[model samples]
Target: ANHGLAGAEFLAGIPGTVGGALAMNAGCHGGETWGIVERVLMLDRNGALRERTAADFEIGYRHVGLRDAADECFAAAWFRLPAGETAASRRRIRDLLEKRIASQPLQWPNAGSVFRNPPDDHAARLIEAAGLKGLQIGGAHVSEKHANFIVNPERRATAADIEALIERVQTRVREAFGIELVREVRIVGDKA
Candidate 1:
């Protein structure tokens, strides 16, 4: 809440470190992390850190410039928020969280959105249309409360179950709509 800059309220509801947020350009309610960035501090493999302008990045939806240069990474960031009231920023945060809780399956254990909204269409709508909501594979179930989310409501979803469910959702949606649903969440490692 220390960031009382004008328009910094958009970062209120996002969960993660500032570097992670900047890396993904995470946004919600029409505000994005990179939009507030004035400059960034990056570290190379050799422990050398340097300041870089926004121009140094090839930023886009859910990505930062370091994708091609894995040797360097984000260490810190400098924001360009203008002065504003802390109270107002806090209120905005509250409002954003309230809005999130109302629509998302906050009662369950889950990762956030599983797929990026494809072009002009929303992923949640597409998933819902595919009749995938509430579909369960073992302990992981596509959330009925929000079609885009997969929840481990019992806290028993194995990593493998979650991975299988994600692939199944992608296939089903593609078969039904002929549009390949691109994943927003990064998947890595061998399946257990």
Candidate 2:
């Protein structure tokens, strides 16, 4: 935005890195990372570098995967952004940041949104409707500010606590609305 790019302003409030954004096809307010990506540099497990385009990957809501199924990670990317006034772009960023602070659980340690929105419905809406907000499991709790967020406000929640809370939210939402909430955050490792 300092460069006066308009399309990337949606990224201004995301908490993770570019690589993570690319990996998850991250977006908010209808602007996905892959939507602006023109080309990307990837490093394979063997340390070989290669360039790929949008066509080289299968892209979907909150998902991206190499069509060739190669093991690789994003190294860099070139984006195609439209030019806009610097001031306007900066204002958009500021507005987005303010919106995030107002709506999200910024004071606690949490993964951004915990679940993908169901088709034609928001996960937060379903979660809140299911009475999951402020629901606690051990030291982690569903954020009162945003039902989609699972926050470790005291920093004392174990990974297991968060995981259990995630499952609890999923189960309750499913039972209430008959919609399965897909996770937006990835969990990897041996179970404790």
Candidate 3:
């Protein structure tokens, strides 16, 4: 944004690295990471580097995966951002950041939005409508400020606590509205 590149202003509001953004096709404020991608450098587990374009992968809202189902990670990317006024891009980034600060539980430990918004509806709204706000499991709770967020205010919530709370939220919302909430944040671990 400082260099007058347009279209990447949404990245300012995202919390993770470019690699994570690419992996998930992360987006906010109407622009997604994959939307500006020209080409990408990928490294497979066997250490072979390959260059691929958008056609080589499937991209969608908060999701990206190799077309061939290759086990690889994004090593780097070349973006194709259009030229724009530096001041305007900076202002856009600032506005997005401000909006995030106001609506998200930034002061507490969180993994951003827990669930992907269902078609034509928001996860936060559904969670709130289900009376799940401030719902707790151990030290983790659905944030009162933003129902989509599970906050660990004192940093005392274990992985099990957070996972349990997520399941509870899913159960209640499904029972009440019959819409199954799909998680945005990926959980990876062996169950004990």
Residue 33 of model 1, lDDT score: 87
Ranking, lDDT, top scorer first: 2, 3, 1
Residues 119-184, model 3: lDDT tens digits: 999999999999999999998999999999999998999999999999999999999999999998
Off by over 4 Å in 3: none
Q: Indicate the residue-level lDDT of 32 in model 2.
A: 96
TM-score of each: 0.91, 0.96, 0.96
**Cα lDDT tens digits for candidate 2, 21-140:** 999999998789999999999999999999999999999999999999999999999999999999998988899899999999998998899999999999999999999899999999
lDDT of each: 0.85, 0.93, 0.92
Among these predictions, the greatest lDDT belongs to 2
Which residue pairs collide in model 1, if any? Answer: none
Of the two candidates 2 and 3, the one with more favorable lDDT, higher being better, is: 2
Please give the RMSD of candidate 2 to the true structure: 1.1
